[model samples]
Target: MADETDEPDSAAHPFTRLTPDLVMDATESVGFQCDARILELNSYENRVYQIGIEDDEPVIGKFYRPERWTESQILEEHTYTQLLADSDISAVPPLIIDGSTLHEFDGYRFSLSPRRGGRAPAVDDLNTLEVLGSHIGRIHAVAGDGGFTYRPLFGLQEFGLDARDAVVAAGYIPAELMPAFDSLYDGILADLAALFERVSVNTLRLHGDCHMGNVLWRDDLPHFVDFDDARSGPAIQDLWMMLSGEREQQQNQMMHILRGYRQFNHFNLAELQLIEGMRALRMIHHVAWIARRWDDPAFPRAFPFFDSERFWSEHLLSLKEQWARLSEPAIEIYD
Candidate 1:
C-alpha cells in the first residue's frame, strides 16, 4: 500500500501518470466493461492490477514499463506462454482481443489475462520440489526447440559488469564505501569469469526468473506465472534459485530436481558448475535493478536498505564469501 507518488520528482516516475481512471479506460478500450474495482498487485518493475469487469470474472491487467522491452520481445513472451499452454503446461497466456495479445491505450502497452490464484509452493518439500522441477523441465523442453532471436542473453557483461556500472553511475554507493565496493565487485567478476571459462553449457529460452515467488501451487500442482524476465540463458539459471540451506541439503534438493528434470529432457550436469556463478550475477543484477528503478516511488519504499554505506559493506562481504564458494567442486547428483 505504498504511494506511487512518493518520489520527489514525480515526472521521473512514469507510473505516476498511470492513474486509476486511465486503468479503467484502458480496460474498457479493450472491450471489457469495468466495474470500477481495481486492486494493485505486488509489482514494481511494472504496474499490475486485478481489475473487475462487469458480469465477468476479474482479469489481471499488466502495463509494460515504457521503453524497457521492444514490441517483438513482448510478443515473443506471449507466444512462448501460449506454446506452453498448447502443450498442456499450466501457464496463463495473454488474452487475445481483436486478433492481438498486445494492446495500446493512451500511449501505454498492456495485456490482459484471466485471474489465477494460488499460494507459494513449499519448495522445501521434496515431493513439491520434484514436481516443480518436472514442470520446469517440460517448459525447457519446449524452450530448447528453438532460440529467441530478439531476447537478450544472460552473461557477465550484461548481468555483472553492466550491473556494477549502473550502481556506480547512479551514485548509490557512499564515498566512504566506494573503494571497498569497487574492489570487491571487480574481484567477484574476475572469479566468476574464470569459472565460466572452465565450462560451456547450452543456453536456451528460460523462465528466466524461476524463483518460488513466481510459481503458484494449487491442488499439489505447480503453475508458473510472470515470464516478464524470460530470456536466453543456461538451463541452470532457471534451477539455481530454488535451492536453499546447507550445501548438503542443497545437494539433496538438486538430486530430486534433476531426477524429475531428466525424465523430460537431458540435463547437462556440467551446467551444475554455473550455480554459484549465476548466484553472483543475480546478486549484482538485483542491486542494479533497484538502482535503475530508484526514481520509482515503490522502489525507495520497498528497498529502504539500498544506497546505504552499511548495505554496500555487507554486500561486499557477501560477494567475497560467494567468490570462495565458486572455487569449490560443483554439487553432484547420483542414482
Candidate 2:
C-alpha cells in the first residue's frame, strides 16, 4: 500500500498521476521491458527519465506536460527531428513504435529515445562556436523549407507581450518594486517593438531554445537536442543565445559563427540588428515561464530565489540594462 503522502495530489499538479509504478507500466505498455531502474532527468517543463531496460541499454522517456502542447504540435516537433536525422544531422529523434513517434499511456503522452551522452559545448571557444553555428546553419537550411502549420510563431505577442501579461496576472512582481518594474518592462517592450519594426527578417522554423545546455559536444562535434520549443522565428533567435561577454567579444564570436553559418545557408546581415531585441524578449519570457510554472513542486525547489524581493529587484535592474542595450546599435561583426 502506498502512503497517502506518497501519492501526488492531482488537483495540485498534472504529474501527480505519474508515480513510479505508472512510469514502469507505461514503458512496458509500449513494449519495452523495464529493469525497474528509473532515474529522473533534469527537466522542468516535461517529466523525463532514464529507465533501464530488462536486457538492453537504458532508454530515455519524456512525458509531455498535460495541455501544454496539442498532439499535432508535439508530432510536428517529432517529425522535424526525424527530418533532421534523415538529413544526416546529429539530432536525436523519438523512437517510432507502431508508425507513431508519440504514444499515450494512462492518459499521459510520452516518447522514448536512446540515451545520448556528452558534455555542454564550449561556448567561449570560438572554434566550438563556429562548429555550433554550422550545425545551426544546416538546421536552418532544412527549416527554410517552409513554415510550420501547427506550431506557434516566435514574436513579441508570444514571447514579450503575452509573458508580461501573464507575469502581471500572476502577481509575481514584488509590491514595492511593481512601480519600477512596470515602467521598465513597458519601456523595454516598446523599444523592442520599435526595433523589430526596423528590421526586415524572414521567419523560419528554428531550434527555438538553442542554448549551451541544449547542445552536447562530443569529439569536437555538436548534437542538438530538445526541439520541444521549436517554432518559426528569426534566424537570429537561434544565434544570439550562444554569445556572451562584452560587445567586442560578441562581435568577434559572431564573425566566427557566421563564417560557418554562411556555408550552408544565406547569412542575412540585416537580421544582425534584431539580436538585442531577441535577447530582451527572451529575458521577459523566461521570467514569465518560471512564474507560470511556480506551482510545480520542482520549480520552488530548483528556483528558491524566484519571487523574493532581492530576486525581483535584481531582475528589474537587469531589465533596465537590457533596455539600455536595446537603444544601442545591434552588434556589428567586421572582417
Candidate 3:
C-alpha cells in the first residue's frame, strides 16, 4: 500500500477509487489485456497513467477531472486533434475503440492513446523554432476551418478580470500588501481592456497552452500533445509562450517563428501589440488558478509558497513589473 501522506486522500480527491487494478480493468475493458503494471504520470488537473499491455507496447490512459468538461467539449478536443493527425500534422490523438475515442469505466471517463516518445524541442534554436513554427501554422490553418462549439475563448474577462476578482475574494494577499496588489492589478486590468479594444484580430482555435512541456521533439520535428487547453483565441496566444529571454532575443525568436508561420496562414502585424497584454492576463490567471485549486491536495504540495506573506509580496512585485511592461511598446518582430 502507498503511504497515506504521499498519496492524495481518496475522499478529498476524485482519484480515491483509481487503483492499479481499476486502471488495468479500465484498459482491458476496451479489449487489450493488461500486464498489471501501472505507472502514474505527472498531471495535476487530471490523473494519467502509462499502463503496460499484454504482448504490446504500453498505452496512455487519461482520466478526466469530474465536471471539468462536458462530453461534447471533450469530443471537440478529440475531433480537433484527430483532424490534425489526419492532416499529417505531428499530433497525438486518442485511439478509437468501437467507433469512439472516449470510453468510461468504473464511473470515470477515460481515453487511451498510443504513447509517442520524444524530448523537449530546442526552443532557443532558430532553426528548430522555424520548423515548429511551420507546424503550428499548419495547425492553425486546420483550426481556422471552423470555430469550437463548446470550448471557451482566451480573453480578458476570464483570465484577467475574473482572476483579479478571485484573488481578492480569496483574501490570499497579505493585509499589508492588499493596497499595492489592488492598485497594481486594477491598473493592469484597465490597460488590458484598452489594449484588447485597440487591437482587433481574428480568432481561431488555438493550442491554448503551447509551452515546451507540451511539445516533444523527435526526428528534428515537433509533435504536439495535450490539446486539453485548446480554445479560440488570437494567433499570438499560441506564438507568445514559445518566446523567452530579453526583448531583443524574443524579437529574433518571433521573427524566425513567424517566418514559418506566415507560410501557411496570414500573420497579422497588429496582433503583435497584445503580447504583453496577454502576459499580464496570464499572470493574474495563474494566481487565481492556484487559489481555486488550493483545496486539491496536489496544489499545496506543488505550491507551498502560496498564501504566504512572502509569496504575495513577490507576486505584487511581479505585478508592478508587468504594469510597466504593459505600458511599454509591445515586443517588436521584424520580418
Candidate 4:
C-alpha cells in the first residue's frame, strides 16, 4: 500500500510543530472539551485528526496546510458543501462555530466537523455504482449555480502545461532518461491541448478529487468527504475516477452510473471524449504534485519509489501507454 500518511519528520516539515497537545488544544479552542484522545487520519497535504470530546461524540479537526489556501478560497469550499447539504446531498460540511466555519488558533487555521464513519465503497458492485452516480448527479444539480469564485479550475494550464514545466525543473529525472521523458510529455501535452480545444465542456463547481479513497460507504450510499480539492471544472472530472477494470467493464459501470446520473442532469456525450485526456492530465499533474512537494520530508518517505530510476522508467512507459490510449475512440455508452 502507498504511504498515504502525512506525518512530518520533525522541524524539517511545517507540520513538525503540530504536536498532539496542540491538536487537542486546537480542538478545545473551538469550544469542545478534549478528552485527550486524538488520532491522526490518513492525509498528506494537510493534517487531520479525530478528537474525543468530554461528553459528546468525537469530532474531526482539519488543520489546513499553512499558506496553501487563502481564507476566501477555503470559505468558498465550505459554502459549496453547505449548498450540497442543503439539497439533501450527503456531503460533510464543517460545523458552524461562532457564526463562522473557518477558525484559527495558535497560528494554524482549522475547522471542526461532526465525525462521519464508513468503509470505502465497493466500486465494482453495480448497485453501489448506481447509488454513487445518483449522489454525484444530485451534487452537480445543486452545484450548477454555486460555481466557486475563489477556487482554481481543473485544466491544462495548471494540471498539464505547468505540471510539465515543474517536473523538468525539479531535476528528479535522470539525465539519460530526459529525452524519453521529454518526447512522451511533449506529445501528450500537444494532444491534450488539441483534445481540450476540440471538446467544448461546460465547467461547474466539482468535488475536484472524487476517487473512491475520498468516498465513504454508509447507509448503502456514498458520502463525499474532503472538498479540499473542490474547484470549478467539467462535471466529468468528478465521475471518471470511479471507473475501473477493462474497457467493457468500465463501460458497464458508466452505464449504471449514468442511469442514475441522467435522471438529474443532462449527460453530455461529448465530455466522454475527454476521459483519456483528463486521465493523462491527472497522471502528469500527480507526478508534478509529488515533485513540487519533494522538499517536504514526509513526501519522500511516502513516495520513496520516486527517488529511483526504475520509478521514472516505469512512469515513462505508463505515459506511453496512456498516450496510445488517447488515440483510441472514446468508450461507448450503450443501453
Candidate 5:
C-alpha cells in the first residue's frame, strides 16, 4: 500500500489516530460493550470502521484523514446533511459528540454514523441506478434552486483530483511502466479540454464523484457516500463520476440515469443527446484518476490493456466514438 500519509500535511491524515482498540475503549467508556470485531473499510483519504454491538445495530466510525487540511470534511458533512434533509434526500447523518459537535477525537477528530445497509451494487444494476438517478434529481433540484450553497476546502489539489496533478501522479509508475501511463494520461487530458467545451448543465451542487461503486444497495435501498471530492461548477462535471466504472458499456448506466433524471429535470433539447460526449470526457477523467490512485485503496483498479499500443488504440476508438455523436449535439442552456 502506498503511504496514505504521502500528502503535504502528513500529520493530519493519520491512518491510525482512532484505532479499533481506541474505539472499543471509547464505546466501553460510554457504557456500550462493542462485541463484534471492527473491520476496516476502504477510503482514499479517511478511515472507516464497521462496528457491531451484540444486541444493538451495526454502525460505522469514520476518522477523517488528518491530512484533510484544505477542505473541512466535517463542516462539509454537517452542512450537506442539513441541506439534503431540507431537500428530503436521505443521507448519512452526522454523529454528535458531548452535545457539541462531531470532530477530530479531542485533538483527534472522528465521527460515527449509521453503516450503509446492504450490498454495493454493480455499476449497471437497474434498481441501484434508479436510486442514483432519483437522488441526483433531488440534488439537482436543490442545487439548481440555490438550495445547496457552500464552498469547498482544497488541499494542494484545487479540486479533489486536480487536472495538472494528473500528470504528476503518473510519476508513481515505474520507468518500465512510463510509456503506457504517458499514452493514457495524455489522451485523457485532451479529452478533458474537449468535454469542457461541449457539455452544459446547471452550475449546481453536484455529487462531484458519482460512479456506481460510490453507492450501496442495502435491502433494495440505494445509498450514496463520500463527499471528499465535492466541488462547484458544471453539473455535467458529475458525468465523469457517474460513468467512471461503466467503461465496458457506459450507455446503459447513462441511459438509466437519463430515464429517471429526465422525469424531474430538463435540459435544452441539445443537452440531452450530448450525454455521450459528456460521459466520454468523464471516462477520460476516470482513467486519469485510476492512474493517479494506482496505489489508492478506494479508487478503481488499473485498466486491463496489454500494452501502450492497446491503450492508445482504445483511447482512439473512444475518441472516434465520441466525435461521431458530437457532430449533432446538445448545447448547454444554463439556468
Candidate 6:
C-alpha cells in the first residue's frame, strides 16, 4: 500500500523529471526555502526564477544536477564565495547550512542569490562598460593576498573536459579542421601545462566564473552571481575570462573591469599580459567542453562564436576580415 504522495518525485535529476512538489520538499525538509519559478534550462545549467518573487527573495535559484558537477566542484565554489563576501565584494554568496557549509540538496549544488534584478546591460552600452570594468578592477585589486587561494579548478586529468577530449580523440573535428585538431589540442595542452607550471602558484579567492553572463545591471550597478566555480587562483585569473572575449586595444570594457580591480589590487604590465593568456586558455577549454556537449539540445547554437557549421565558417571568415583588428596573441584562462 503506497500513498502516491509519499513517493519521491521522479523528475529530480538528469534523465529524470522534477516536479514542483519535489523542489518544495527539497527546500522545506532540507534547510531553507527559495520560491523559484522554473524559467529555462540550458546545456549544462538550470536557471530558475528570480526578481523578488515569493516574499522578497532577491535572486534566482540555480540547482545544478550532479551529472554536471561533483561535490568537490561545489566545495571549491563555496571557498571563493566566502572570499568575495569576506572581502566586501559584490559576488553571489551561497546561503549557509547550520551557520556554516553551504546548503546543498537533491543530489545537486544550489545557490540562491540576487538575480541581476533586471535586463543585463550590454558590453556595448555606454556607461555599462565603464561600470563593469570598474567593478571588475575592484575585484581584481584584491589580488593574491586578500582572502583567496590557488587550488586548480581544472586538473590535467579531470579538466571537466574529458568528454570533449573523447570526441577529438575519436577524430570528431569538423571536416575543414581535421588536420588542425591534433596540433591544436597538443599545443593547447602543452601551453596550459607550461603556463600552469611557471606561474608562481599562490592563493587568492575569486569569483571562479567571471564573464559578461555572470554580471548584470541591478540598480544601475553591476550585480554578479554564479560563484559556483569560485576557488583559489591568481586573482588576475578571474578577470582574464572576461578580457579574452575582446582584445586589449579595444578593451575599454575590459579596462573598466581592470580599473575596477586596480582600485583594490595592482599588477605589472607583464603580469596583466600573462593573466590575459590565462583568460584565452579558459576560453579554449570551455569551447572544447561545449563542442562535446553538442549532443545536448540546450547547448548554445554554436558557442564561443556561432551555432552551425555554416555560421562557424562565416565566423572564421569574419575573423580573417578582422585579422588586422586583432592586435594581441593569446595564452590560456580557464578549461
**Whose TM-score is greatest here?**
1
The global C-alpha lDDT for each of the candidates, from Candidate 1 onward, is 0.88, 0.88, 0.87, 0.88, 0.55, 0.52
Q: Give lDDT tens digits, candidate 2, residues 1-335.
A: 11213322336898878998999999999899999999999999999999999889999999999999999999999999999999999889999988988999989999999999999998989998899989999999987845798999889898999999988887767778888988898888888888788888888888899988899888889999999999987898899888899999999999999988988998779889888888888889988998788778888788877767788889888878888887787788664
Instruction: Write the number of the candidate with greater lDDT, choosing between 1 and 2.
Output: 1
Give per-residue CA lDDT, model 4, range 104-163, as digits (tens).
988899999999999999988998988888889888988884468899988999999999
Provide the TM-score for each candidate, comma-separated.
Answer: 0.96, 0.95, 0.94, 0.95, 0.66, 0.67
Model 1: lDDT equals 0.88
lDDT of 5 at 182: 54
Clashing pairs in 2: none
How much does each candidate deviate from the true structure in C-alpha RMSD?
3.0, 4.1, 3.7, 3.4, 6.4, 8.2
Query: Over 4 Å off in model 5, which ranges?
Result: 1-13, 16-18, 25-33, 69-73, 99-101, 121-131, 145-161, 173-191, 218-220, 237-256, 268-335
lDDT (Cα, 0-100) at 29 in candidate 6: 51
In terms of lDDT, the poorest run of 10 residues in model 5 is 152-161
Tens-digit lDDT track of model 3 for 243-288 = 8898889889999999999999888888989988888888889999
Candidate 5 similarity to native, TM-score:
0.66
Q: After superposition, how far is residue 12 of candidate 2 from its true place, in Å?
A: 2.1
lDDT tens string, model 5, 1-335? 12433433323433534667777665554445798588887665566778877788877776665544333445665667657766776656655556633644445556667666656665557555656666677667665733234555211134213633663455433355456545654554455455545544455666666665666666665666765566655545555355534334455665676566666665333344445555555555555555544443333232444123455456556655655554553433233
lDDT of 5 at 193: 51
Candidate 1: minimum summed lDDT over ten consecutive residues — where? 1-10
Identify the runs in model 1 with alpha carbons over 4 angstroms from their true place. 1-8
For candidate 6, lDDT tens digit of each residue in 1-335? 11212322334425244455555555555444556554543326453533234565544556665455565666666665566668886776666656644455665455655454545667666466657667766665543554423344434344523633654553334567544544545555565566556555444666767766777677778777766566555555665555435454335445565555555556443345455345444545555565545444345433523333554345334433333232355432221
TM-score of 6: 0.67
Residue 244, candidate 6: alpha-carbon lDDT = 34
